[model samples]
Target: MMMTERGMVAPVAGGSVLAQFDDVLAAAAPELVGHVQAVKFDADTGRLGVVPDASAYGTKLRWCARKLVTAANAKVQGANVRTLHVLAPAAGKAGPATAAAALDRQPAAPAGPVRTRETVSDGYCRALAAHREAMPPRLADPAIVQAVERQNRALRELSRQAFPKPDAVEDTPARLQRRRQAAATEAAALRRARAEKAGRQVAASQRLEQTA
Candidate 1:
């Protein structure tokens, strides 16, 4: 036990404050009794520091720290416990930190096998062939395969979104053909609309010229 400047005998190693806090918690909030440990009282600032048994309790204890101080100070006179500071056990420790550092240093697992263009095309072709066979089954079958494989290569080269492989939707022949046809139709419609708009503007200018 040590005597403070206020002429009060302070608890040695926080015995008085810890005892007071334990009694207060036990009477009021019994469930939170063991959540906090290592109680310390600051005579100067009226601040209280507590080390939680585990980090999980730190958040819970912090939320009600002020209430805990009031309860504790009321229970034990002369402690003057005010603001509560919850100290996590692992905050300044090295064991858990070293383990985390080692984990970060460990090499990552190798990625799954990348599907090459030929491999992907063969897989798709095999899946397609399972449904129906193409003419000559060898020569004619390669047309869709080559088209999709070429597109996959081009797409993979263009953007990171196409990384590892192109979208499976682009690999399907009927879907690819439909997408191309839709794009062509939209482009043609846009061209016709622009031409019609330009003709209307020209007609309006000619009418103004005639009026002038």
Candidate 2:
């Protein structure tokens, strides 16, 4: 097989050609694999055929064939991929049967976000749910009131401790005034710079006229 700086130009063949090509393709453009439904490489002819999942992706593969070839050649020992051929699968048959079959198979529902009992938030929620059960309706009114007040006090303390009062934020009016002042200062500086530049240019022109 012929090789160049750009990449392999000759035909490639071997027992592990398919596996090697997939690995190279994945390494070169990981996103391209998802767009491609299947791959068929003719080592004898130096042609690489790709069955794209969609028409747009088929066009995309053609556009980026050069970079793809170069990358694959760099990874594979004797990869000779001269041309990239985008194959259009026949009706109801797109690429490999395995891929279509896999798509038809329903995947198990993915596990959701896990909440551990050990977390403070989880414990707090659990405590709230069980609080009424702990204090049955038969409990004395005074005892219930005392329990509620104690809970409120604890929550208030926790709120204070968990989130300490931030330094007083500058009110909107003051913030706006500061921004306006800064903008005015910047505008003045810009105007001064422009004036200085104009003065320098005028001085240079005058010097040139005198020299003439």
Candidate 3:
């Protein structure tokens, strides 16, 4: 395979075919663009190798493999890319001798500070809370909200594990109701704040119009 002008790898025989396939793939799955490292096609085997930038992207590519293969075949006429094979990152050329020499030349990396259970729990909870707060208000989708709640619960569990309190009482019906009430109150306050901001912006615009 040879690198095209756009840095994508394509087979020598049908570089243009693969290039068109790449464009089609990008259009079909825009999210997979940067994540895809390269696309290689084998005419004899009728296999298209998709190299992802990371392992996580590889899983995504695999999930959408069938759709991609269909798209590729449609885009590249007579270029039958039947199977999609997600390839791992190419191994480095460094042998044992090379690695040993490099190790001898470079200084050892400093050890990172140890993270205690308390610290881990505190940091995780704080991060999760911040993430929840940072999410856009428009993203009120049930799935997204549930995902965030799951993360919040997981972080709370971790915190409990770090600092187990024997005297801690289980969440009763009244306690759950109170918690829900508090959350509703917080949500109302946030909506009021947003509405006030919008009102102020509108007032400012009207004043500007009057001056003009």
Per-model TM values vs. the true structure: 0.37, 0.35, 0.35
Q: Judged by lDDT against the true structure, how good is candidate 3?
A: 0.69
Worst 10 residues of 2 by lDDT: 6-15
Which sections of candidate 1 miss by over 4 Å? 1-6, 9-14, 90-212
Tens-digit lDDT track of model 3 for 1-212:
23444444434435655556557568667787755643456776778665665667778889998888787777776666778877653324333343334434445554896676656676878999999999978757899989999999999999998998977868899989999999999999999999999999999999999999
TM-score of 3: 0.35
Candidate number with the higher TM-score (1 or 2): 1
lDDT tens digits, residue span 1-212, model 2:
23533345433343244446567568766777756653556666666665666667667777888877776667766766667666653333344564444343424444895666655686778899899779857756898899999999999999888887767444598889999999999999999999999999999999999999
Clashing pairs in 1: none
Q: lDDT for each of the candidates?
A: 0.66, 0.66, 0.69
Compared with the true structure, what per-residue lDDT tens digits does model 1 show for residues 1-212? 33675455554424577656678777656667766553456666767666655566667777777778778777777777668866544333324343244334434654897666556566777888777754454456778999999999988778765454554335678878998999999999999999999999999999999999
Number of clashing pairs per prediction, in order: 0, 0, 0
Clash list (residue pairs), candidate 2: none
- Total clashes for model 2: 0
RMSD of each: 21.3, 22.7, 32.2
